[model samples]
Target: AQSVTQLDSHVSVSEGTPVLLRCNYSSSYSPSLFWYVQHPNKGLQLLLKYTSAATLVKGINGFEAEFKKSETSFHLTKPSAHMSDAAEYFCVVSLGSNDYKLSFGAGTTVTVRA
Candidate 1:
């Protein structure tokens, strides 16, 4: 069985400060990991993905994550936080290709203090 755990339920940061959101996952096989952000009453936006390819993956909005197999972790980070970055983030794992079945971790809500 595969599952993901988000370390923080909520994170607060001042605008322009660095942001970090931790996630840990367990998989039976090589897993496709993703970070998705959801704004108030909106759909999810892909932050990044680890698809058995690159260890360090760069994403939109100055976000990035490193896939650490040994640590069984994929943590999202940003150089500076923006007020618009305030939202809910979910760590997800895909079971297989062509299958949209995604297992989502309990979300982490980011609060950006202006």
Candidate 2:
């Protein structure tokens, strides 16, 4: 079993500036970690994932996440924030590859300023 926590409930950044969303996870077995983003009234979109392949995983829209086993963290970052980046983000964790159970974080709301 695994669980995830998004450290910040809300984050605000200026357009064209860097953006960061913190996430931490706990798992009993090897886990598959994923970051999902959802715009208002839209389905969640996959941002990135880490499945024990690489410690640093890059995703669409210039987003990236680094998995740190020692720190038990998988924080997401974007070099430059865009207006479209304003949305809710979730941190998800699943147990084994075949495991159907997925734990999700509460979500972090990102607000982009001009």
Candidate 3:
């Protein structure tokens, strides 16, 4: 069985500061890694994804993450934070290209202070 673990359950950042969210995962086979953001009272939006080609991936809103095989990690980061960026983030792992068998992390809540 595969699993995804988010190291931190919450992260707080002041507006205009940098942001970081950590994640780790284990899988029997090579897996697809993804980061998604859920705004308050809204649906989940795909942030970035790692599908084996490139280790570094860039997502919308100046978000980016690196897929590290040695550490089995995929950490998301942003150069600057905005108030709107305050949301819950999730790390996901999917095996063999099927969405149904995906495993989601507990979630990291980001709070941006003015």
Candidate 4:
């Protein structure tokens, strides 16, 4: 079994600044983690993912995350924020037992201010 918890419901940042979103997860076996972003009335897009192959993962739109086994955390970060980055983000954990079984976090809404 694998599960993910998003630590924040909302995150606000200024345009052209930095961004951070927190997440925690648990799994019975080694887990695969993912970050997804969704804009209003838009489909979810894969932001990044962490597999056994890499501890650090980078994704499109200057987003990245680091897998920390010691803390059971996979936090998303961006060196600079853009207004277009305003969206809802989800933390996902893959249940290795089942290919279709995936747990999703509630979601964190990111607001970019001018």
lDDT of 3: 0.94
lDDT of 1 by residue, 1-114 (tens): 788999999999999999999999999887999999999999999989999889999999999998899999999999999999999999998876576688999999999999
RMSD of 3: 1.3
Q: Where is the poorest 10-residue window by lDDT in model 2?
A: 94-103
lDDT of 4 by residue, 5-92 (tens): 9999999999998899999999776799999999999999999988879999999999999999989999999999999999999999
Winner on TM-score between 2 and 4 is: 4
Local error of candidate 3 at residue 60 (angstroms): 0.6
Provide the lDDT at 28 for model 2. 76
Clashing residue pairs found in predicted model 1: none
Deviation in angstroms for 53 in model 3? 1.0
Q: Could you report the Cα RMSD, in angstroms, for every candidate shown? A: 1.2, 1.2, 1.3, 0.9
Residue-level error in angstroms, candidate 1, position 40: 0.5
The CA lDDT of each predicted structure is 0.94, 0.93, 0.94, 0.93
What local lDDT score does residue 68 receive in model 2, on the 0 to 100 scale? 91
Better of 2 and 3 by TM-score: 2
TM-score, one value per model: 0.95, 0.95, 0.94, 0.96
Misplaced by over 4 Å in model 3 are 97-100
lDDT of 1: 0.94
